[model samples]
Target: MASKQASVASFVESAPPGELSNVVADIKALAGNDASLLQSLEPAFRKYNEEQYATVKLPGSSEAVIVSEHNSMGDNRYFDTASQTSFQVEHSSQTASAVQQHPLESSNADLIRSLQKSFSKAAAEHFPSSVVGIYPTSSDSDIAILLVANKYSPQNFWNGRWRSTYTLSPSSGGLKGAIKVDVHYYEDGNVRMSTSKDVDVSNASGADAVVREIAKAENKFQEELNRAFVQLSEGSFKGLRRQLPVTRQRVEWEKIGGYRLGQDIGGGRSK
Candidate 1:
């Protein structure tokens, strides 16, 4: 059992982020439901979850800029405050390795080009004036698409992002994908909404088909978010807002008019 635990620890230290879950499942099977070994690996899992998604550490800061809970997408998206640049960490389903690269220069040039064209068309048709970016994963078989838009003025700001990741199957060439939507809007206070959706692109024949399918799914997801926002505004947020303070008192007219109202009731006052 100790040997098993040691071996599992060693493998985790060297395993790719994508395979970590599989490793745990394998250990659970081997241990025959022995919870001790799995419990021992908790720290490792926590560390991996906390550290793997963090890309940039600010100068003079001892910790990562972002720490997020583990999710199957295994994506890292963060904005650097100092440089004011957004960074993404992409993972390839083929290699299970993570890499940071611009999508245009990827080895899968043809695929990236096709995806970019599709993305542009969709963005222009639906979300004008939005910022969009495409990133290449570790291998040549996957791509991550990011769409961001924000409206800000003197009083309020609204920010939203839709991130989609697509991986092509080696045998069938079909695409498997997921989309994550995040919304943060500030008016008199802060309001946030986040949602994840699974995109069914397995039947999609080509890159254009995949993008269309994703768009359809995204529309539905957006509707869900809209409903959620309305509920939050009417329910949770409404209850939390401040209306009036407990200390209540009448207005003092003597200080405002420089004389007591009782002393000068009529239009004719002391000249």
Candidate 2:
């Protein structure tokens, strides 16, 4: 029989790339059966929070100071203040409470409008422009969340369950020079919420121009995601009794000849 260490080593070898080192460390600790070894891993778990904070910067000022560092379950929120603007960065797992919320049973025009107003207010206050477009990647649930957050009714909410991409452009009577935000859902149950803006500030020279652009984009992305999460949690969407069960299925069509489809099978618990 192979030793426990040997077995763990084999498992680590076959594990997915980027996960091997962590897997090896975990297995080694388990094999040792020592509580202290497990405790030591806590620092590794916290490394992400530190690294995320290191990338944070305040716009328009080099003298920005850290205002607060709030730590929650597997996540951290850092607030930094400068002369012109205050900035915050939330580093959290995809499964963070802000990202995962209960789905809404139904939606209405008034509710949608209210959400849009809130989103616009936050965007206008934090960025150069409001969110002019929302691109959904992989999940319509995100769009549903967006519609519920923005107070805009999704056109085909009742038109059978399917995913669609929405573009709110200036040509379509939306806000001109509006920031573009993308909401992406990952298989690891993580959400990648981000935003971008076009910058053409006049009279700004050298690195200051580049720094200002980056600061604007980062602040916009952070504020949008944070505000959307808050909206989703505020009794607007119905909460699930427990986490939704997720399953993946592969379907092959012999009649269609050489066609294969993959589907994620899950839904909110029936009321």
Candidate 3:
């Protein structure tokens, strides 16, 4: 019986080291793969959470920007995050007068639809992975447009919360022949930055020309918005970080953790 016990212990000691080591390595590899998979899936999960709760608190109801969350769910979920930030840009009466015979003055809905189509096209061209939506105000006094850039990736590791909101209205008096633009930008639900500019498109000839001018202004604002995001992400606005609300801080913390883990694991695998 003692010999039998001794034989069993010897067999166990003689087992291959590579077999046990390989098993341990495989377990670690699986853990790493799980972390990677979760990292890859995080964007979609965040988008789902955002859509489920991030309803834009508009002053009134408008269907133009109320996109179906389910329909927009997928790889580019950042494009679906709803924006609460908004501001207005007013077009002068003189510009309207110049186009009095134009379709915009005749039907406000038509004007909103036209601008939506033009702006949506331009946004797509400028931001390849962006989602654009335009909604006319219930009172017809203004139109709100949202642009969301879907640039989040586990590999590249960005928060992917960049968005811009533009509100367009009809200007009064001296502002005629120009579009007074109030642009608001949000990152992770915080209004971290904004800019206001008067775009002089008085020289624009026709309706199409006017649309082109607006698109140009939108593109310019978008460029500034992108720059502001870069500045904030690079820790240039450390002072502003202290002012962030608790909700925003939580969002930012999660994003930072996710990206840092992704970078560490990615670097480890490469070595």
Which residue pairs clash within candidate 1?
A: none
The all-Cα superposition gives candidate 2 an RMSD in Å to the true structure of: 20.7
Q: Cα deviation of 214 in candidate 3 (Å)?
A: 4.4
- Summarize candidate 1's per-residue lDDT along 111-142 as a digit string, tens digits: 65676678767866776444344445555455
lDDT of 3 by residue, 8-110 (tens): 3343232221122333344346546555433343333333323322222233434223232322323322121123223121111001011111122223456
Worst 10 residues of 3 by lDDT: 91-100
**Where is model 2 poorest over a 10-residue stretch in terms of lDDT?**
156-165
TM-score result, candidate 3 = 0.34
What is the per-residue lDDT of model 2 for residues 1-271, given as tens digits with 9 covering 90 to 100? 2364345434543332123345646656665766554344433333433312222233444332221222122234322211212233332121111222222222232333343444435445544422211222123122211111121122322111111112222112222222334343435454444444443333322223323443464466567767877987764564633234243434333443533333222333432
Query: Which stretches of model 1 miss by more than 4 angstroms?
Result: 1-107, 230-271
Residue-level error in angstroms, candidate 1, position 21: 36
- Model 2, TM vs. native: 0.22
Q: Model 1 Cα displacement at 186 (Å)?
A: 3.6
Clashes of 2: 8
